[model samples]
Target chain A: QQQVKQSPQSLIVQKGGISIINCAYENTAFDYFPWYQQFPGKGPALLIAIRPDVSEKKEGRFTISFNKSAKQFSLHIMDSQPGDSATYFCAATENSGYSTLTFGKGTMLLVSP
Target chain B: DAGVTQSPTHLIKTRGQQVTLRCSPKSGHDTVSWYQQALGQGPQFIFQYYEEEERQRGNFPDRFSGHQFPNYSSELNVNALLLGDSALYLCASSLTPGKPQHFGDGTRLSIL
Candidate 1:
């Protein structure tokens, strides 16, 4: 069972355009939602994170819009640049001390300059 | 200051062999977790260690085992390697078990 499901396995956007990726989760126990960016041959880096208490959280050009009732969340990147071309992963985990993350397959985004 | 450091960066093993991978956590972190990432897929959790004990584990087989030292560094061991075990093994560290984890570049393990 895939607890977290992400849409649009891949994406392409022009530089300076807005890029959006969506995710839906089946586990209601999940309280913390985070996004990670990974470049080829490297490890996944923490990008942005949000809690169920907030409907939205924005950090720089990256924004995470979360809907607790709907069990859904989305990531929006403003002014997408060529540097943003990489794989984005959405993950969820419970607030319990021993909880492990459940990750979405991933979305590969490409920004053309 | 060092986020997370994994050893060897790459390794190759044949079937029925055994391997060990190492990880050093961030300076102040105390928890270590292991993950396996197949090509073109997201990483899957293996297990986590805290206070030199296995606190939590994922659904991986018994073949995957780990150890956490007194310094918070960890090691992953796999016995009787199988071709299906070929993947990028990632190590992550956090201040606590459920806290935000920092990842290393990972060690690419290939099984023949």
Candidate 2:
């Protein structure tokens, strides 16, 4: 079973526009949600994360909006830039146990200038 | 301090052969996790090691095993490799299990 599901296998956005990626999870046990960005020939890097306790968390131009009751979350990038083009993965894990992250299939985002 | 470091950026192995990939965690980190990422797919967790012991494991087979040394370095060994095993192997390190992990560039393994 895929614990987490992400939408839009691929997305194209104009530079300076808002880019959004959506994710829904099946396991209500999951309390931590994190997004990772991966570049070619590199490993995935932590982008932004949000805990279920907060409805929204923002850092700089990146924001994570979470809905616990809906078991859904979304990542919103403001002022998307060409440099932001990369594959994004949304993951979730139950905080009570070991940190085994269940990830989504991944979404490839392209921000064109 | 150096981030998570993995060796042998790439490797080629024939079916039925065996291979080992190594990883050194970032400074002061204590936990190491291994993941396998197939083409066009997100990473799949293999297992995690903490305090030189396997703490958590995913749904992979016994052919995939790992070890963690006192220095907080780890090794992943795959036995009787199959063509389907070809993928990018990634290593991530964190101060604690389940925290935000720092990843290495990864080792690309191709099975012939």
Instruction: Identify the leading candidate in terms of lDDT.
Output: 2
| DockQ score of each predicted structure, in the order shown | 0.72, 0.73
Interface RMSD of 1: 1.5
Q: Report the C-alpha lDDT of model 2 over A1-113, residue by residue, as the tens digit.
A: 99999988999999999999999999989988989999999999999989898999999999999998999999999999999999999988887435698899999999999
Which 10 successive residues of model 1 chain B have the least lDDT summed? B94-103
Residue B86 of model 1 has an lDDT of 98
DockQ, model 2, C-alpha based? 0.73
Model 2: CA > 4 A from native: none
Candidate 1 regions exceeding 4 Å error are A96-98
lDDT of 2: 0.94
| TM-score (0 to 1) of chain B for each candidate | 0.98, 0.98
